[model samples]
Target chain A: MSVQERKQRERAERERLIVATARELAEQQGWDAVTTRRLAERIEYSQPVLYSHFRGKREIIGAVALQGATELAGALRAATVTADGPRARVAALARAYLDFAARNPAVYDAIFQLDGGLAYAQEDTPEPLKGAFAALQESLGEVAGNGVHAGLFTETFWAALHGLATLTRARRLPPEYIEQRVELLVDRLALV
Target chain B: MSVQERKQRERAERERLIVATARELAEQQGWDAVTTRRLAERIEYSQPVLYSHFRGKREIIGAVALQGATELAGALRAATVTADGPRARVAALARAYLDFAARNPAVYDAIFQLDGGLAYAQEDTPEPLKGAFAALQESLGEVAGNGVHAGLFTETFWAALHGLATLTRARRLPPEYIEQRVELLVDRLALV
Candidate 1:
């Protein structure tokens, strides 16, 4: 490889290492404990070296949120693709969304709660954020009635799923009834 | 009043002053700025005196969450009572919820996101927490189909609303479509 190409590859690798380390630290001790100093120590790098890759903790969170949005989109696509019917697809999507939140609480918080400095709902919003919403709309559009505004319906459905994930994580909803609740949401939203 | 009664009343008044100061600071600059030391200074009380009322920052957050929950329940109840039908009631409830979250971002964060040591979904869950859920469920029950489980439906509906609120606050959803989204949610959950 040329010198410039080799250096570019090395830079990308270092960025990956930093994000992986931040994710591990956040998962291990929660987001509050994942300070820039702690992250540098964990990765055995100087704080300045870490700063070269990320502007600050918020930027690191933004990186993580982007990674999470990609994963969420993939999961939603998988759930929707494998289902047999529109209602089943919606139900699977809800379950996948909730399951992702349950498994990655810190990442979920980064994407949904923390001040990640990522632009949202604006023309300048990052591609990953738009991609995630598109994934949901693709699945939901199949169920929304013809002549009905699918985008609006998707927004409401997405809102409901987000609520369930947050409420469940907050322990506001009983754990054992999660499936039934998802079913209810799908059934209600599916019927024309 | 006797001397003991006067002293007790004075202490209660001081506690109220402290909480009010904290709430104002939070509203002005967000929750991150509402530190215990800042609150103490704002209330013109020593750190120890503030601690006498609240164990620490987390306890103060819990107090704020409780207060927010009470207000949330009142809003939900008012919305439900004023609506002419089940779908209208649910729409009203959703709008009220979004309005509350938008107006009291700090208090909403305290109840939903911050670690306040408040028990939830457990046998020992606090009354305010249960009261908030009860308020939502009471309205949801009016629209939920016969044979649909009340708790499960309420949870699903709540999840959707919560998702919308958090996403809107995070700027993940467009603000202009909030009313339309609520209408879609009500329609999806009610007769369509």
Candidate 2:
């Protein structure tokens, strides 16, 4: 209720607007087209204001990546919760993961492909990144098979899903039979 | 050889030199550092000379991708030929594939990550790309399991390997336990 607290809230809102605009611009015209100047222009703020919110584009990318990771975690959890069994849950997780990649490719690239200047799989990794991994682990660890480390199994399975999403997007793999590929991946990799 | 034959040979040699120079520069200083002007200077040729061999950077990437594919095919075949059984051969193939990606990061990017003006998984795909896929298929198709199409199985397996290669390189995954991951992938995915 204090004046300073209201100002802080406004600052946070402006930061969100900047990130949303950047994501929208990137989605419309790939990451290369995203520049601080253009982002400032689109948000109707001075470059200084944009800089105050983010050090530069790398930081912006990191912000987007964090947001994407959080969304990805939610999407994966949602997909799995609706499925009936372990196998179905795993399959749903894969579908949701791929669908996310296909639909929001720029955001996916920010999280995985581009240099978002974010640490990963380490003690100091950001909470959103860790949360995304934990989401996968929750569904996949149950089916990690006997004697396989759940974390390792989740990493391997995640890598496979990442590959499918990437190759399909890159046109390295044909789009046809994607469903079959997912079924085969789940049927073979999951212990259940 | 006749004068005409000698001229043809010399032209082919220059083309090779251009491709090699571009690849070397890319490997040393990521692909972003590669440009027609830099490439011409490195090869001791003019920009026009470089252009004569390929239309532009995209075509140059295609050439590198083709070269990488040929090398990858050879590496995979070599690794599997010495292995004892289907399971061992598949493991060897996975290791060799990953090794190739690690050793030739830029070339690997050219083949998979960069826009190389290349057609993939299509009838009109370049010969070297097809050869590389065929090499993987040779070892993997045998263990595709009953009632599974060999090509589909090979594609799925290839995507998993790709995910591992890409994520490991990007530092998204921890470096340790790669060998175990490979073993788990082969054991679980292959019917062997």
For all the predictions, what are the DockQ values? 0.81, 0.85
Q: Would you list the clashing residue pairs of candidate 2?
A: none
Error of 2 at B113 (Å): 0.8
Please give, as one word, the docking class of candidate 1: high
The ten-residue window of minimal lDDT in model 2 chain A covers A48-57
Choose the strongest candidate by lDDT. Answer: 2
| Alpha-carbon interface RMSD for all candidates, in angstroms | 1.3, 0.4
lDDT for each residue of candidate 1 in A60-144, tens digit (9 for 90 to 100):
9999999999898998898889888777787788788889989999998888878899998778988988898899888788888
Candidate 1: residue pairs that collide: A160-B160, A163-B159, A163-B163, A164-B159
Model 1 Cα lDDT, one tens digit per residue, B1-192: 599999999999999888778778988998889978888888887789988898888888888888889999998898889888777888888889889999998888888877788998778989998899899988888777888877777878777878888888788788887887887788878652
Residue-level lDDT of model 2, residues B1-192, one tens digit each, is: 599999999999999998898899999999989989999999888889877788888999999999999999999999999999999999999999999999999999999999999999999999999999999999999899999999999999999999999999999999899999999999999998
lDDT per residue as tens, model 2, A69-168:
9999999999999999998899999999999999999999999999989999999999999999999999999899889999999999999999999999
